[model samples]
Target chain A: MSSTTQIPFVDYLILDDPPYLQAQECKSCGARYFDRRNACANCFANNFQPVAVQSEGVVTSFSIIQMGPNPYVSAIVDCGGTNVKCTIMKVEPTPDHVTLGMRVKLMTYSMGEDNEGTEAVAFGFEPI
Target chain B: MGTDAIWIIGSNMTKFGKHPDKDVVDLAAEASRDALQDADISLSEVGVLGVGNLMNASAGIGQQLQKQIGQTGIPVFNVSNACATGATALRVAIMAVKAGETDVGMAVGVEKLAGAGLLGQRGPKPEAETWQPNGRFGALSSTEGRIGTSIMPGVFAQVGMEYGHKYGGASFELFAKISEKNHAHSTLNPLAAYQKRFTLEEIMNDVMIAYPNTRPMCSGNCDGAAAMIVVSDEKMKSMPSEVQSRAVKVSASVLTSDPYEDGCQILPDVNTLTKNAASQAYEQAGVGPEDLDLVELHDCFATAELVHYDNLMLCEEGGAVDFFQSGAPWRDGTKPVNVSGGLQSKGHPIAATGIANIHEIVMHLRGEAGDRQIEGARVGLAHVIGLGSACGIHILEKVA
Candidate 1:
């Protein structure tokens, strides 16, 4: 044991910005899709372009989870360009107020600071 | 869909729940022997073996079970699909028999929950990242981390809440009613883990596990096994004509997975897979959902059972609450659901659930379901949902 105290640190760097969720736009059908695939699901088109979407969308459906190990606000977001299912974050009031079809914006923040004081960020949506 | 090819001649299940005295091998042997006896067939006649299991991958489960039963040289395979493992194994066995790969095949789903003392008690411990709670924002650190805290109760809780929100009812009340119904039915099932009936008052007042869900409303972890024998028509013909006549035909078997699309709530999420699979099963059986006299759904939670009522097309979306409130899913209801007590009361020995569901449906169709038996039952359906929102649905028809 040494007299000098050594601080522990996270081994790897984690991102603090909202990582972009990747999707595809079919060249033939102009249909946008999440969950990456080589061929387009809508028209079976092989030609596609990768698109990065912002976390702005409306809640299509949501559930107020009361049970389980880890309970959170679960919802499905119908982003105008593509629909994405995700969890909402940092709501001050009751989960019931998070209505279906409510407009929301994405938030990016450091989840926690590393041993080196580096921040690890993640993406979540909040009511606008 | 091969006609006059394959049939499920025999099925059986061991009692489910904690059994420290018995291990996986014991459970499997008991179920296997019961199934063989039910079919009146010898172990030597089985040309293929399939085992369904999860969380216990300590080597070859199929081989271990085969050795326990004193049978060897037959091809053995293991299958895992979360909660649908049993159904998946049965499908493989049925397909093999239909394809003429084997004359007689057996599917066994055995698990020892006692060995899995806690969620992560058995096998290699999952990385710490996988243990993170949902809503923990950041770059997921491990493969398990991506899965989040999507356990059975949590997943079904969302469904219960969704039903409450959409139907303008109290989620707790609906949950209590569903629990009461299942408990009442379980009283008639001697093999059920929870045979005592729970009043709505008791269910409502129980300790809360998740919002709107209580201890009585959720399924308990249990240990046991179930087995079924599938034989070709030619093989069945060699047996007595009376035995062949009593055999149930495999009308349809279908499986589907989640699309994981946006605007898809985890709860009440339209499993396009379940819908498509149900459609295919219905088409193969040459019948529709309306023709079914009874159904066995994956009711790991009361909420799950309610959502399945809608998902399986027993009723329209958001109509399950009303159906439950009206006692329409009870034993005497128009479409009796979970007459076998369901996972909530019957016990969810994960690997055993699928085959156990089939066991109960077969009993109902054969007019042997004792006190919970439905009268004039001609058609029955069983649906099971697994991890990643995967689903498997099978439709069984009684032979005229």
Candidate 2:
């Protein structure tokens, strides 16, 4: 048996212990963003602090994408005040199964493994 | 600004469809030549040249155009601004003349996108369905599949759905109906990519692209080119009576980008910037939406057109659905829209779309449009929006 080491797919995603997303919150406007930035897009302040994003969120908008390799649900989730774009995993990709204002929580799953037995983990939101 | 107005003396475009025999520069040169002939102007008289191209930006299309059309030693500016590249190119020429850099300037926009599939369709995996990671952790996987979508159809699909959720309307059939109208309009436009009309049933039952948007509802990806020649008021006075008689006045030319907005960065906001541009254009032209006789908007998707009706202020606030349901955008309706079949059938050649839209408007305003002409069309508006968040609007008036 081979032991696999897990790694976060993006810099904003944390893999240690409980996986959660981290955002660069503006010190001036209190705006949160997942990507790294030199200044806040809202107030244009150069200072930003990395803050942990809430795992639970409500679906604000979604689309059932069929153009992909397989049918999947692409959605924007409103976590408290911040909005996150993610796929709704572990649910049927249907209008009845997925809907607006649906409650979901962030979860990590293995995408695939490499020659070194290192697993790349990606995050998605699942029904809570 | 005193009668120091700018006028589009000549405008022309190649039939928007497959041009297997011609290349990009060939199409650009043809359109430029035709436009110059229409203007009764010679290449030696053109003071500046602005070329718009997206897929072939690094090629220095402006310099290449000069080689084919005549080398007048004029300032050449090659611009690329997503779908708005063409409009941006024309803007460059207008600005040159406005700044007293040149009196007569030429702007050309060309693109060869025939057989180009969906805008953001992803390619094959790294290793034939098998992953062989080599990085410190592993091969970096994209956020597209795991997170929300990045494709144009999906983005617009969500945007349309959001509009429905907010205001309560905009059904799937409604969006399909919008596509049907555009397809029907294409039947009269010989230059359109697909001239055959599709019924509402056919459109609704067509292959699904995202959700509400079917295959027929999307813009046609085809090859085409359009060119325009602009002259200042001072130069227009010196032109012949016949040459000045057909010139169309450029009342307003406005371009805008995305402003900082919350929860909209991931999915580009197509409405805000468009609304901003439309208002600015109307203000600059000293007119309102009621004054528009016809409009050629960026209908990259049927769903997009609905939101833009409101964004363009063609209708009342939160009344896009009502505007369509009222049949005001039809060819014979009160406010004719996309009389040239829009991008849906006119074909979206990217860089060419901007100038092509203006070309359609100019043709109608001059009462030169053949079968697809809007009768008594005097004031027209041309709009094109690019995904990287750029919106360009030009309001044209027939010089009396």
Candidate 3:
């Protein structure tokens, strides 16, 4: 009962140096995905390489969600060439704060703590 | 002579919106009964059943129909693909007829969500919360959901912003105009959930569900059902003159799922895989977007319809504003779209929404739309995308 356990939502998250999101990039077509799969979408290639995404990105799309789940600022950020969908952190989800094409850097922190004190750390894009 | 062509001889839909007294079985059975009547065939004459419903228990629907109608021991196939449930069922029916597996099959879709209290039902129970890591909402999309939590509104709203950023000309108000067009179109449709027209200002000013989307611009939960009776040419030839006279040909039916990608994933595109679907549909129907007289697209959100205009090839990229305001997709215009009010005004009953779109197109093709009829309508297309998941597109032509 003394074993320590920390979990990220999905297997894509890594707690390594200069921590960044890892995605599956197709070896043939260079298509990348956030989830694991059997084959590449573009070329149907079975071989893929795990690539760490760039930490810096540009906000291609942003939304100020007012209802349903929670009022959090979210955006689709284009990191280098691939798109990274993440929530915006440490800023209000208002028109003044969330701007398109805004430069952002990847950041990770504790999303929430379960009843057993296990931390679920989530990654997000913060305005630079 | 090939097993490719199919025809929809009859279609029926129950009145949409909240039905406090009626359960789904009763509603689906009624639609099926009316469909058989419309096809001028007795229940005992039916060959098979393809029923569509979603996120609700419908295991008894087949037996319920058998009891309501004469006990016809026909095979029943149920299909579900999110919001595309109806069209998916319709495709199954068409394939059945085309393959000569059944001469006459019925595609029926129903949903009774109003009294179901979906929010309480869909949410996690107290016991399940213990398993959820950090007790975060699980229904939202993967990486995005882990950061923020939401259902459809937040994802679609993000699509709205992404659309705006891409086009640079698209605005939040542009989405309101799309809603107003569909709402105005619904006033002439008695079966639509909301027949009242609203100004664009009123639509934008309504209760904000998410950024850039108000209640009026969002699809609503409702209880509704739609059914279509499809038959092969041989079976159709044996139909009565009255039924045959109004029959609509199912020229093309294409279903596609999202391509695995890393893009903003509200859906692959507002078009779903519609580019591939529409092209294949056009080739099957031997018609293109230019040949379409009317379109009954899935307007789950006004933004979807706007982006779909480009995706469907009805307009150029970023040309939705002018294409909409140009008075084109109106009832009397060159290419009328969502003349049946769409999900915005018609209310989205999930599974029924797709078939309801088919029902409207068939009615238009047959000159039976009444007040919302597109004069001299020749061909129509209906498209629906189920989440960022799957899509179904059907093209219909009136048999003269």
Q: Flag regions of model 3 displaced more than 4 Å.
A: A1-9, A38-46, A68-70, A112-119, B1-4, B57-60, B115-146, B261-272
What would the per-residue lDDT of candidate 1 be over residues B67-139, giving only the tens digit for each residue?
Answer: 8786669888898887888888888788788778889999998877653422421233443432232222223
Pick the winner on lDDT between candidates 1 and 3.
3
Q: How does candidate 3 score on lDDT?
A: 0.78
- Rank list by TM-score: 2, 3, 1
Model 1 segments more than 4 A misplaced = A1-56, A60-72, A81-87, A92-104, B114-149, B159-170, B259-270
Task: Give DockQ per model, in order.
Answer: 0.20, 0.49, 0.40
By DockQ, the best candidate is 2
Q: Which candidate is the best by TM-score?
A: 2
- For the predicted complex of model 3, DockQ is 0.40
Which of 1 and 3 is the better model by TM-score? 3
Query: Against the correct fold, how does model 3 do in TM-score?
Result: 0.90
What is candidate 1's TM-score for chain B alone?
0.90
The sequence of per-residue lDDT tens digits that candidate 2 reaches over residues B19-81 is 999999999999999999999999888999999999889999999988988887888999999
Report the TM-score of candidate 2, chain B only.
Answer: 0.96
Best by lDDT: 2
User: What is candidate 1's CAPRI-style docking category based on DockQ?
Assistant: incorrect
Estimate the TM-score of every prediction.
Answer: 0.83, 0.95, 0.90
